[model samples]
Target: MNQVNTVVLLHTVLHCHFTSADSIENYLFEHYSASMKPRRNQNELVEIDIAMTIQTVLKVDERFQYISFYGWFEVQWRDEFLMWNETEYQGIKKISVPYQQMWVPDISMYYSEEHIHDLGVHPFVSVTSQGHVTWFPGAKYTVQCYLKVKKFPFDRQKCSIVVAAWQTTDRMQKLVPRARSVNEVKGIAENGEWEFQNFTYEENYDAEFDLTKIVYTLEFQRRYRYFLLCTIMPIVILSVLNSLTFLIPVESGERITYCLTLFLTFTVFLTLFDQTMPRNSIDVPYITVFVSFHLFLCVISTMVSILTISSKRGQECDSRDTQIVPLESQGEDLHLGEVNADGKRSGSSGKNYLRRTLKSILKEVFICKIDTVMLVMNFFFLGSSAFVLVICYIS
Candidate 1:
């Protein structure tokens, strides 16, 4: 048997020791001017690709008509000025430089009404041997968008983050597909009030300005659990409670008090709810209507209670007036009539009293029947309203 020995040697190269920082700086300074773009000519279309990942939804201000969000923005383009031969620099493939030294394109959010906040957490500049320049800007954008809030807490909203060149139009610049994977892009710190549904990308053209715009539309559905537990459920309960006033006996005088207290409570809740929303009169919110309906029901119940009290007082006054005449006749008979006349007058007085008593009892029975009918009607209204509201919320 023969034994064989095999050996392999691996050689590693170190280029950082030989390549001086001054030489790289000098090359960059000579090749790139402060005002020059990476393109060869003014008409040359410099293509840039944008890839962004949503980090958090800071705030969606309906009152101010703006949405604040944090995202990671990566802009990539080929820089002919930053390229160097790899073989000439002892296999040195890349180098880092200050961001301020390069002439970055002025890509901005077209719909942004305010300045974007950039969190300088990472290095702002990158250079590669193949002449690729990348800028990773921490994008904290506050974009202005119109929000339709007719449904409010139960509303789904579509918002956009539009990106375009500030001074350069589509004739001079173009946007291409992103090189990085976009599947990982998502809302990191989600807002408790809203749930991220999905998002889409679209390219829009402005005919008047001849500009190409890139848009990222974010669709969000509001999380109604908070409002349901805090505002909506309480208002519904108050509505039912107010409607219960009709079940109370109007003569108790407490019916009006109960309804009035409930109305005031509903008003307090309404005020609080209003404070959380924008005060636009263009479209009234469903929540506002619901609260107002409860208040209206309370008012109607109070009026009914007042009417009942008035009716009772009027009946008492009539009874008193009827008794006065009978008493007077009885007194006059005792003074001026013989036994036969007195006996006849007493009988006649008794018959008239019985007739009036029967009439008063009948009137009271009729009034109670009306009260019952009203109570039934009010309860039905309350039930239907609650059912409709629940359907709207769930759907």
Candidate 2:
């Protein structure tokens, strides 16, 4: 019936020159309705040609797990009601004017973190006499994406954005890609932290929703130079220092202080770093493992330092007691006589034996100087940290 009307209008109105050129649009819009689908028959599905032209990547927030980008959606669909005979419109092939609330496909973003879709630059669409409508609406789109930071500053992340007609299933309308695939063709603004490697588009039928979802998987490699200089470099330096803590001579008595200081510093840094990462248990970062191992190293160093100091003090106390006993213990029997002066020989003998056994055991830990033990322990911890770093690289 619509084709018969168009045939009759072409014959009758094709040669009638209008007094005003505006009459062409007025005539075309007269047949357009905002609420009804613009198909010749309501049962005929409208195909919307969809494509994304990314202008730039605004930001990728790791703490919040979202990505923001400035882009335009190239949407084109046919409007059967808005078709016209070009000869009747003074040979005008196309027209660009304000969008007249014409029916458009109900396509939407499935992974939008916040709802802030807006019409770009006054909402105008170009319509050809053949009834093809082209609209490029641009906006800053924020999509919720899960980020993996196990490698931290050197990690590559994969995020996806779903474009689908959520309200209208595939049976109601079909979405056709304007191009073979989506990519960053337009000039992309460089991001300091994340490097846009590339993107791939997946169009597949979703069985659960009975809808075909267009998912764009974006791959990004972190620009690790900044992190290497700032975050990772410091961690490496601290790990090396933590291993060196044992080398501090126990004779100076500062090894204990050094171990405690490094432990506290690492703890503080770990706490600060935790705030910048997503709070999820799905994956533990290798950097965290590296730092934690060093922390455990600090604890072990502190324990060794304490035992060495205690052993040294015990020797000094024994030396002072020998000098005071019978003028430097001129005779062994004189030393025994002085120890049992309180007439509690049995109790004093038991105490002396236990003290000697404890000091003998402590001597095993130090022998003479605990520096060798500390160096060996440091090498072991250093090897463990290197192993963790290898894991981080492989991952």
Best by lDDT: 2
lDDT by residue for model 1 (1-395), tens = 12222221111223353354446667767867757778767567778887766788888887767888877777788877787776766666767777777877667776675643222234557878788988887757788977777686788888888877666677766766464444433545767888887766778888777777778888888898988798778877787777667678766768777877998898898787677667778756777878888788778877777877787888877865443234345543522221232244323455555666687887797668767876787789888887876686676
Mind giving the per-residue lDDT tens digits that candidate 2 earns over 168-227? 777678888766433463246677777887766778788787777778788888998988
TM-score top scorer? 2
Per-prediction TM-score to the true structure, in the order listed: 0.80, 0.83
Q: In model 2, how many backbone clashes occur?
A: 0
Whole-structure CA lDDT of model 1: 0.71
